[model samples]
Target: MTIRVLLADDQALLRATFRILIDSCDDMEVVAEATGGAEAVALARVHRPDLVLMDIRMPGTDGLAATTAICADPELSGTRVLILTPSEIDAHVAQALQAGASGFLGKDVTADALLDGIRTVAAGDSLLSPLATRVLITRFLSAPAQGAPPRASEDLGALTAREREVTAWVAEGHSNEEIGERLFVSPLTVRTHVHRAMTKLGARDRAQLVVIAYQSGLAQASRPAQR
Candidate 1:
């Protein structure tokens, strides 16, 4: 199946460049392009693309708000957002995940890496590595945004023990295969647990699941592994 994409960027040159590159791929196609956040949301609703390649700093609405709206709409449940920014600032990465982006990538990535990132997010995988992901979430999401209501730890009550375990591992940025290895289960089983956790927690994707795990204190950030 072709991975339908909506390009959301303010620069026409970038959009055009991306369109040419994406359309060259047999497995994906650019279904639409939006110059700003509001148009991205509108075009997303109309096309219902499989994935949106979103830029964070567009005028009016901005990518984070647009991402929140798209993820919250039941009609757009199958659609996933992948944030593409010129700068992969820590706060932006954290906010993008909170906004329900499935993955985050810097615009400076190679053409192949960008294409692979699209496939990864479209396939419901978070793009960051386990250690990097943990550090980012632990640092940024550990504290609730100012004036934002505190999230209840009890909100995790709906998940089973195994689901919770899998979610914690996910929050640490472990892939299904790695989690399964630790649990002595197949990757498919790990995926099942992850999906169940997401369903129970109302998570938009693995990235949001990570956010929830940190916000609810199910996962704690640890020092990065010694290189």
Candidate 2:
């Protein structure tokens, strides 16, 4: 299936460059282009693209505001926002996430990396530049990530030994492929374990899985600071 996308950026030249790359992909198309944040929302409403490539800085509402509006609207249920920005600053990172952006890509990312990121976000997975992702977590997505915890740690003794192993890497932000590689299992197997682990732990998405890993003492052993 073709993945329709909307491009929003203040720079007409850069927007055109990105369009060239996106249009070159057989399964991707750029359906709308907006030069400002407000127009972005309007175009998004009209086009209903599968994904939005958002710029952090724009006149008027800005990308954070536009992302919040578009993602929050039930009418645009399948649309996910991919924040495309040059800023390594954590404030915008935190804001975009709070606004419901599913992924982020640095402006200087290679063409291949950018395409991969667009695909990842469009597939309902969250992503961030490796370094920027770390920065984001340390600076903002950390403590109080999902509001106050009910206790010092949540229970996880229910998991089988193998299930516990997978949960540790999941909290470390390992993708299915990564987990598979580490454990000498197939990605499909890793996925199965993850699914079962989440069921047993009553966890949410991967991010929350990370939170659980930490709370359950799984991540504690691997804590870089503890070593």
Candidate 3:
């Protein structure tokens, strides 16, 4: 399936550059472009693209607020947001995740990495840059209340034991394949558990699931390994 993408960036040059790159790909295409957050949301509502390649900093509304608006809209539930920013600060990464972005990538990433990130997020997997992952683990997930309100443990009571286990691994930044390898299950089985957990907990995506895992005390954040 072709991945329909909406490019949201204030820079016209960046938008055009991305448009060219995305349109060149066989499995993906640029469906629309927006210069700021409000326009991004409007275009998103109109186009209902599979993914929005969002920039965090913009003139109005901003990408974080736009992400929140897009993710919160039930009509746009199938749409995913992938935050692309020049600054991958801790707070920005945390806020992007909280706002329901399925992925975060630094602007400096290679074209291949950006394309891969888009595909990864469109395929229903969360993609975080290495720095973003570290920030998520060491800052936000470690102190979930700082990023968002904490969920009571009973909120997690709806999840099965395996689902809870899978969620914890997800919080620790394990992909479905990695979680499956660790748990002696197939990746598809792991995805099933993830979907079940999301349905039970009312999570928007894996990123939100990670937030809930920490907030509900199903997962404890720890320092990421040094590369």
Candidate 4:
């Protein structure tokens, strides 16, 4: 299926350039465009695109604000926001995750990496452009985690034993195909299990869903989520 997308940037030229690259991809389409954070949020609600490309700094609300707003709403749960930034500072990267932004990419990324990041985020996975990832790791490691984590899936009490297994794999960064291989199920089945988990947890997308798994103590790196 073609992934529908919204591109939000303050620069009109920048937006148009990215729009061309997005529309050129056979499996992706630019469904809407926004010049500011507020416009991005408003357009996102109206178009309900699968992914949003948000700029970190802008007039009106700002990409961070728009991402927070969209990610917080239950109605806009399926939409993913990927932040575009010049650099990754600790404060911004940490804040973005708390606000529910799914991924980040540097503006200087090659066309291929940019495409890959979009597809990754659309597929319920997170991506940090290499530069962004390096900065985040350094900062995240240095910064002291300030608050308690988000409530876990167990608190939701909507997942069955089997569904919890799927969510655990998700937290470990396993894709549907990878999870299916480990579980001895078809990828389609993996998707079903993940879907069930999402419904149970009331999660909007995989990034936050994984966060829930990690924070809730449902998912760990040492072991896959087991039924």
Score each candidate by Cα lDDT: 0.85, 0.75, 0.83, 0.76
What TM-score do all the candidates reach, one by one?
0.88, 0.75, 0.87, 0.69
Candidate with more favorable, higher TM-score: 1 or 4: 1
Q: Which runs of model 2 end up more than 4 angstroms from their true locations?
A: 145-168, 181-184, 193-227
Q: Is candidate 2 or candidate 4 better by lDDT?
A: 4
Worst 10 residues of 1 by lDDT: 218-227
Superposed by TM-score, candidate 4 places the C-alpha of residue 167 at a distance from the truth, in angstroms, of 2.0
Separately for all candidates shown, the number of backbone clashes (residues 3 or more apart, or on different chains) is 0, 0, 0, 0
| Predicted structure 4, TM vs. truth | 0.69
lDDT of 3: 0.83
**After superposition, candidate 4 runs with Cα above 4 Å error:** 1-4, 11-13, 25-32, 42-50, 73-79, 86-91, 116-149, 225-227
RMSD of candidates 1 onward, in order: 3.1, 4.2, 3.3, 4.7
Tell me the lDDT of candidate 4.
0.76
Q: Give candidate 1's TM-score.
A: 0.88
Residue 227 alpha-carbon offset, candidate 3, angstroms: 21
What digit string (tens of lDDT, one per residue) describes model 4 on residues 143-220? 334675546334746777667888777665567787788889999998888777776776656656655665566654
Candidate 2 C-alpha lDDT tens digits along 198-222: 7777543344455456544566454
lDDT of each residue in 160-184, candidate 3, tens digit only: 7778778877777777788888888
TM-score for candidate 3: 0.87
Residue 144 deviation, candidate 3, in Å? 4.5
